[model samples]
Target: MLDMQRRKAMQKLALLGGGMALFPTLDAQAKMLEKDVPKWDEEYDAIVVGSGYAGTAAMLSMMDRGLKNVLMIDKMQYMGGNSSISGGSYAMSRTSIQKENGVMDDPEMHIKDTLKSGHNLNNPEMVRIMAYEGLDAFNWLVENGVKWKLFSRSGGHSAPRNHSVGVGSYITRPLQEQIIKRGGQQRTRIIMDELVYNDKGIVMGMKVREKYEFKFDRTFDENDNKTGKVKYYRANAGVIIATGGWAADPKVRQIFNPALTPDMPTTNHYGATGYTIEKLIKDDIDLIDMQYIQIMHVTSADEDSFGFGFRTITGGYSYGMMINPKTGRRFINEIADRRICSDAIFAMNEKGKNHPLLIMDVNGAKTVEIDALQRGIEAGAVYQFETLDEMITKFNVNKEAFLDELKKYNAYVKTGKDPEFGRTFFKYKDEYITIEKPPFFVTRPGPKIHHCMGGVRTTVDCEVFNKTGKIVEGLYACGEVTGGRHGYNRLGSNSVVDCIVFGRRAGFAIAERYQKMVRS
Candidate 1:
């Protein structure tokens, strides 16, 4: 019996030893203590470590490319992460919508706008791809049942190209439906503990924690987590890290940018602590653009994240304007990119002034969806008044100065020029929007950490690279988790495009590589 048991143990060891060859470098140190073969609880062709736009896109793309048995996992109990609550703005150029809307835009213009918004630090090649293929991504979503309408003008783009849904759910829900329809699997509450790399330094899979509970009350420390059951998941094709950025992790944010204090709120979800990227970095993966955290400068002051209060500001910035509470005057260009707006707001906060007042007229309010707009009003994040005088009384504005500023702003609208701040105002139905219409809307807008412009480095094909500048074979990344596309500041509405475009690339690349390997 002893001899038979020994033989069976050796046979099991022989069968499992090669599987535990993942992360050879890290395992070598552990092997010094004990040589234990990791047992895999699940196996799939592809594993996507997020459930947002990028991860969903990757799964859908993989399934579309005939790669079955793809699984998407999220640490959070609910899927969609920050994407579920996002504004659902997708920027694309040279689309049917643009042509139909008679908006003059091309790929060159899109690329130029992206680069300019990133302060010329963006990857030109990635920007080129995003611009050229944006229409395809847009069409893909539409074909996959995303009902997007109403092109709102975003701040840095020269033309109106921000195609939006009422909320982000409109985009994520339909794509999730398509993912299920295509036979992809999605599991929530599964957190990645460590990436499993084979002896050749190729990523093979991940060691994960099932039923993981994210600690939201404490500072998010990825290494100190205690909950969940340990399990290993093997991915034969590849592992795509679309785990998004570290905006919600105050500690991570302050490490890269000290100005991002702990008190500052983020638009990202609590689970967007960036543990997956942190694991990769600890395992010697290269990270880039770590200092460029982006902030949304026009969010409602009362709201914790981009929820409820955001709908009002979206329309306010598009059609109305922001004015300093004390001065009752526009400080920065209302149509400027996020960086400029955020810096201006931060400067105001430093001076001990309240968050700036964002006000829009009936014409601007027309841009907001009726239901959401009503909800914002009911939540008290948005205040509505029948007249500018009533708005002044409600918010205690400098009535005379505010009226004078509006007069000047309305003049600029009529002439299609903003000489004071160089704002590029939008024209609705051949007429530039002005705040002269009745029933004004106002919200106190402040800054919130919105996006992390820095993360793991990836090629144009979305293949993650190691610190040695060599490709970590079988490792892919896309969306906000991998940086290179946006330079210093990401343009509004561009993140959605980034996720879908690169996510599709990562998915297709993994599928093709796996198919080739099988054929070979």
Candidate 2:
């Protein structure tokens, strides 16, 4: 039924400004008029939206401080936005990695990596707070259930302080479980349409509507079918926007970035839309670095799927090797910093007309399907072909050129060497592997521009800022919505670290605000 309505809505969508615009059709307008929006007259001490690492941390922290009236909200039926998809890596200081290895890393270096990575575009204050306070947050996550194992730092970083929570940010399940166990109120699959405003220009509550939610069936067919009424959550205490970046918003991406205009490569959740953020900006909310976007280097075997098990970040090997189609050869080292890798991928895609070529083993081809494919195949994220020749044909590469590329790669595989690019000897741990197996897999890589490094400008304590960089009263934001942590590109797993450490701080901070306001 919901699918029917969505299809109808799509049909009723009109083409305007060269894009499919979903303005209210006459039917929608009439339906909206027929129904009264839910009145959110009750004010809560605190309200936190989004269930990712940041949201969960904030929610849990608020409860810890006896802010029982708080409510946690999310648009997805399931909690944990990008946190669920994340690899759960955390950047910290004075940790076992540093202590055991005697690696001398301080907040200065972390701040430097963030600042230099962002090209100094990040907020210095927020960056400083993040770097200095990261160790505690990293510890908090491990205490909560986020397990840590040593993952070779993929991008450019000074030390081995990079720690992953075994599952990355996907531990949302456990975090949510903890939050629920604490008796915190959780409302999932409800879209936060808008923030309620008071006459004094302070935040009130929020207008929410139960929209599409994630329905997990082994069948895997779930959606937002409930044409529910809009509700409200009063923010008499504080409102925290934990909603993540806008990777799922296609139109917005097209408008802001031309390279991701079509089929380039991006790994974002289906629900990371910045709808609330857009509305907030329209309502005069301040933002930081809205223009600085981050792109990732993705390698998939086919046009349909994205390759995972990042050999650069993880030592996992897949069927094919990544290449720069323009040079018709491997270019920058895959283990190079993410910024360089992203630049190389975008340049190659733009130059090669978006058809990246891959070379893999015929035996490795077998690894391309089934459990090896995992969620990719079930989610239509990848496509498989029988032979390297067939895979080349699908990608529209020069057959002879593709064969020649494979010949050279195979020679290197037999010899334990890649002389052309020196990729095998790259610093990242996974560069040395042999894909001499059958059923070589090929996939189209998509850059995950999900976590916006730029968001509502905020202080380290997580206070939302105005355009003049002044703190907005009665409001705070953290997680992806409050950016300025990662300078340009966030190191893998670092964002989750920032979210939890800072999210806990935001919770305590907001709870204190509520207490002060109550006292006053």
Candidate 3:
């Protein structure tokens, strides 16, 4: 009898559209119309709204805490979001990798570097948590089969603390495999083309439209013909919005951070828009530092190939110097923090300068991995010249001025003092690489929209707060979706650690609350 009734209700929904409607029962529909409350279609113990590093970390933590009915979803067809395409460098201190590399680093040093790089606007407690717990997160990744063998130095770090898995799939793939191994396909249901929520939000459930391509800049309009059947998902415990930031959304980027216009290309994936952030704002969640977007200090001008266009030039910059082609002078210290270098480049561009050249010698090229350098060269991003005159003629740089600058830089390299710019080398300081050795390599690189240090404000443990400065019950956030971990800028390689640390905290917090509720 119940099956018959359900079939009849499904038939009614099919009549209304192609599939399920808002409410199945006529009485429930009447109640919804009278009270104007959203009706939930399905329920789970917990619902995670992304599948990136943060979302996967949160799910793993929840599963560890004995939460079996947890559901993870994503708007994209693939599981990994921006994390899959990321450079896969994670900032972790005092890890086994650091110890094996014979580098002495600690959480205090990590926190100091992070705070300094962020210009001291970072939340101290949150920074402390991430710094202290980062090593454990690294260990977690290793224990779960993430093979990390290399440790390199990025822009703002005090030591060689950045650990890389070569590619982001090293972190994401293991987590995905673990999820499938533990719970099978049904355990992690990733729904694509689903816009999770709208204005009416306590995160009780999410309104999902199947086969719909969501527009990030605007709210959903029912009149759109391309949209598919709408469904709702309820969270019995809480909802975790681990969706990334708005780096790729030009409209939102222009509105919030006007300095980053639509003309500038982004390193983020297509799905790294502000749709979730917009929905959270409509739900009255407190947003912080929306205007503080960080641009990558170096990227290739060519868009056709992959090597240097979207790839972060951190390693290149760390091992090379940025020179203004027209003046043939080093404009900024290439080893400074990401924001400072990007700002310096922007300042040069504001003065009507050409795209700055990142020039490196053979030894400097040796500082980076050989395979990576070869890939960039093969992709036509990195140009190699046999001599100074060849480089000058090819790039149309002033011959005399360029040679003069090179002489001055070589002098500094010998003396181990960069008095002009006070540039400090994080690695390879003992054996400095001068640009005099041929063949020479150069690339015109500049900043592109990289990271947005802004989103839903949350506590140290990742519980989201409202406009009234009170915790919104049954709601949590993690990863790039929540802000305050970074302030005006993020330190190099810190994002992955921030995601893992806080994502686990959020999962544990929600699971504890749910367990307490069950006991009561």
Candidate 4:
């Protein structure tokens, strides 16, 4: 029966052109075939197919480079795609914050840390650009009225250079406000529920369904089918695809990595589906590293409230430890980078049976903000216990084994050594806090589909490439839409910087091309 269904799906994909096989069902293909070719409703110098940090940065950079007419569109009703839902931390080096905090960091250090975290599979040129240009991008955010709360350390970085701005809105909101303030609102039009494309293997324009609503039902086959009045907007200069990754689509995720079944939860927004990628693939764009899907280690398993979304646990691995519920012992270093921790949890699952538990004391809880912890507790995503005994009894963990594990960890903390996993305490180092205080907190944090380290391959200049390694004219990509920046695994906080740095590159490149065309 499953084979029959698979055959039918393949046939339907063939009918609609094989590139779109990743769509939910054949109903979407039928809708596409039935839709009329829309007449151009408007034209612009450049059309950006997302409103996240990448798209916003691209549009703003184009405007700064004297390109007045640009259109930014998103399939969702609001702007700030997955970027707005992010932890609002950007990895940068040698910034004012780093200097103020008395931390010694530079782009060279950033580059080394990034390459090491990514296992050196990253493009050397792209890594250098992102690392070196990060400080400038940080200043750009500040110049545009975005403020950083402080500088802190994340898992992969060697220094306390992850600049935080509360949530993603701290940066996205300011960018939006600045766009509106600069009389660019007229030139910078944002149409919602629009999916742009390349026409006949060349950059052109987009097709949109205005005012369409997104039904949260994932099982609905016709969710992405065009419903409202369809319109097309033409672009004279080029089209920039910053439409993010395929983490949200189970079908596409499984197509890339078979182990990532539909049962796995994801931290991506609903719009993170790879519709744009499918469209680009149809245009002959090359996709690389599709199997390198990165999972985030902090996510809730509760399906009712904030399901699949991350809880803002402030202290991270520095203040807590991850324990195997079955053995009631620390199995992996909680402070390791996301991939290491996530892979460890996956390996320990033992035929996909159990999830690891992250436990912390009051001091660790204090590292996280009170409001965030309260929100998690109210949502029933986090649990608090008055004592170790209460926690052990509540979770049905082996009390003796759990206590022994905690005791062993505390001893290691006293000596500033994680002998078992070699967990580096980058921020606290010798002053690392012990998980001994009462009123302990615990949450089951499993891996969630987080990032795709692959997409339409691109050059360091943000120009998309074809399978033959030739540049696709008038087509640009950035952010998660482009591949080869962070080879196998992405370092924490580097994603935001990647979006901004390459976003500017794409913007400037497109603007320069547009000006040359005008001059000719």
Q: Pick the candidate with the highest TM-score.
A: 1
Q: Which digits, one per residue and each the tens of the lDDT, describe model 4 over residues 290-405?
A: 76788877676543322422444436465888788888999887877888888888888664467677888887777676777887887777889888888777777877888898
- Per-residue lDDT of candidate 2, residues 1-520 (tens digit): 6336434433443221211322211111111110243565556788898888888899888888888877888877677877777667677777876787666878888777766665554566666777777777776666776666554444656566667654544467767777778777888777776666565556666777766454422122122234456666678787888888875565555555555554444566667664666666755666655544566654443332124523321332223466544445665555455666666666667644574444444444433334435545445444455665566556665567545666777677667676776654322233434455555544455444545666777777888876555676767888887766675456655687678878988899999988898899
Candidate 4 wrong stretches, greater than 4 Å: 1-39, 185-201, 221-224, 303-316, 350-353, 426-430
Across 260-280, the per-residue lDDT of candidate 1 in tens digits comes to: 788887778788785666577
Tens digits of per-residue lDDT for model 3 on 169-241?
Answer: 7898898788767772222223322224334434455665555544433223312324555667767777787
Off by more than 4 A, model 1? 1-36, 218-220, 350-352
Output the better candidate (2/4) by TM-score.
4
Ranking by TM-score: 1, 4, 3, 2
User: What's the lDDT for candidate 4?
Assistant: 0.75
Our model 2 lands, by Cα RMSD against the true structure, at 10.0
Local lDDT at 456 for model 1: 83
- TM-score per candidate: 0.90, 0.73, 0.86, 0.87
Please give the lDDT score at residue 388 for candidate 4.
83
By the lDDT metric, which is better: model 2 or model 4? 4
- Candidate 3: regions farther than 4 A off: 1-39, 184-202, 213-226, 304-312, 350-353, 426-430
**Candidates sorted by lDDT, descending order?**
1, 4, 3, 2
Poorest lDDT segment (10 consecutive residues) of candidate 4: 25-34
Q: Evaluate all candidate structures by whole-model CA lDDT and list the values in order.
A: 0.81, 0.62, 0.73, 0.75
Could you tell me the TM-score of candidate 3?
Answer: 0.86
